[model samples]
Target: MILEFRTYRLKPGTSEDFLRVMAEDSVPLLEKAGLRVVDFGRSLVAEDGHEEAYLIRAFSSLEEHERQEREFYGSEAWLAGPREAIVSRIESYHTIAIETSEEAVEALGRR
Candidate 1:
């Protein structure tokens, strides 16, 4: 399996709004396209005034991840949803992809 860790450095004071939109709009859309939405949270450690939003999603393989990404991004649903609102509030973003074993996934208490 592969896990993707995504971090969004939100514009100051936008964390709560971003998280609310993600919970209401973003996650359901991604899950509909077959990505496993593992977790979402705020970072405890942050810059003096900047807040970060963290997300974890998993896939069976890189190929699967690519396929789902294409589907999600290409969908009209995504275009019409909270994507614009989500992107506009972000100051920066970063992502890390890691290969892992099923055992490791289970160890994290995730399927």
Candidate 2:
């Protein structure tokens, strides 16, 4: 299994709106497109600057992750959905994907 962790540095004071869009729209949309959204929420403290948030997902493999994300991004469901609201609030973001055991993933979910 593989895990994809996305960390976002959002525009100041946008955490509430950003997380709302993510929970209410983005997560469901990605799941509909065959992605597993493990968890997502605002961080307790900003990592670098502004407001910080994160999204974690589980994928069968890196190739599957890449393909699914590509299709989801290109799909009209995304372009016409919460894409603007989700993207506009982000100042910057980074992703880290790595192979992991189910136990490891379960541990993350427990948090």
| Cα lDDT tens digits for candidate 2, 35-73 | 888888988886666799999999989899989889999
Summarize candidate 1's per-residue lDDT along 19-67 as a digit string, tens digits. Answer: 9988888988888867788888788889766899888888899999899
Q: Tell me model 2's lDDT, rounded to 2 decimals.
A: 0.90
| lDDT against the true structure, each candidate | 0.86, 0.90
The alpha-carbon root-mean-square deviation between model 1 and the true structure, to one decimal in Å, is 1.8
TM-score of each: 0.90, 0.93
Candidate number with greatest TM-score: 2
